[model samples]
Target: MVSLREREAELANETQTLQTAADLFDASVSEAANLGQSSASVLVALQGRVDAAPLATAEASRLNLLQVAAAAQPVSIPTYQRASIDEKDLVDVGKAIDGVRLARESLPPLVTDVRDARSTVTAALTSFRGELSNLGSAIESEAAKAVTINDSASQSFRAAVTDAAARVKAAQQAGGDGLAEMPVYAASLDALRTENARILALEQAERDAAPTTPRNPGSGSNTGGGTNSGGGSNTGGGNQGGSPDTGTNPDPAPSQPAPDPDPEPVPDPTESEEPPIIIDPEPAPSGTVPGATS
Candidate 1:
């Protein structure tokens, strides 16, 4: 039997041999970054060879480069079998030999795959660029259409406004009832006035809702100039300003209270059957006047 040290040595050699085979296989399968670049460069150079080459010729050149890349094969890497110095190391040697042989056999097909993949990537990139260019053109066309539509709409709005203004002017010059002269224009004017009133009310509401601080806290209360002036004139001159009751109710005739109704007439006592007789509680005292009471 082989010594343990010898067996270990054989194992180490076997491992190294296998690792070399794996490295070769990896290199064969993986294409370098520059593999397709060389072919693309050749195609680009050919474009400059002729002054403005035909489109067909340029496309053909590119296709030919791609085909050449697809057809190219990778060179096989040389591999070595681990030498078996004795029968004890034969198993490791056999395994190493098998691994190296497989790596060598797989290289050509792997290289072919790498070349085809590179060519496919290049073709895809070219097609993508073309599609992007078309998309850009379509976007520009749509943008121009939108601009045209906007201009047409603007012109139509301006024309409508001018026509309405002319009709309103003609109706005013007619000097009859505005509605009689132009019903449609009058209705539109009424609608506009109503809208303006609504907008005014909304604006007032918004102003009321907004928070405010007095600018001059020291100043006394100040009513709005127009509102106070108009209100004072309508309330029977400013002399009546002191009476809170009279200011709101300008009609004094209705403000006076109605008089009370007369009481019901007493019944006529003389008309009754009874005659009047003066009452005497007792006889007058001796030597007293007849009418005197004691």
Candidate 2:
């Protein structure tokens, strides 16, 4: 009974920091969610612009507009890159949250130094805080690096879009039906935009599943990646996929975490003279994220 009380006492103390970390972690997750959306939006637009630039360039060349064709040169599309935030940290958080709960309810070994209870979590939290601080920079760096070809595809995308439009207008001004292919060009551009909307973002059904990691003797993992990119596979087809800290008598048993709401389309796409209609991608009708326990 004495040892049980002592173990509880230690966990109770760790609970305070857990609460604090969870709040910060959740906030970071929100910000990251927003950033991820923005990144996806930009990349999708860039891809459309890069792919569609050729139509404009071709029209310009056929119309004998050397400058317009030159300006509309295609910006190379890149293999999409994302900030590689470690998935382990997320899993650690989830496990720590779960393990602590289990420790309190189920008896861990009697002599277990509850101090070790928070070690994995403490380390993970420390690592995560450091990574979170650099998250924006990391994201920016990845975006910048991936788009470097052709002098930054976003800038290049915008210029291409603008020049492409210019060529179309120029054709109108010259009284020569430019390329006699306006319909085909417009149709193609529309198709590309539609495809971009369809292909880029996967349906996310993220759940904060019950902590799956068992509590071990000396260490614990606290994060289930907290709904980050690596939490689970957001399958192309559609569907996929919190805690508390308090010292003293422990808060009532924590309810298993709820599913994270699917991500919405985030903002700030590169606009063009005739920008593609970038719709806020609607949520996928239905799908599952792999790795969700329930």
Candidate 1 lDDT tens digits, 15-95? 455455445534432332233343344334323222233323444544544454455454343444345445357666555
Every candidate's CA RMSD: 29.8, 56.5
> What number of backbone clashes does candidate 1 have, counting pairs of residues 3 or more apart or in separate chains?
0
Name the runs in model 2 displaced over 4 angstroms: 1-9, 48-294
**TM-scores for candidates 1 onward, in order:** 0.22, 0.18
What are the clash counts of all predictions, listed in order? 0, 25
Of the candidates shown, which would achieve the greatest lDDT relative to the real structure?
1
Error of 1 at 11 (Å): 17
Cα lDDT, all candidates:
0.43, 0.38
- For candidate 1, report its TM-score: 0.22
Stretch of 10 with least lDDT, candidate 1: 176-185
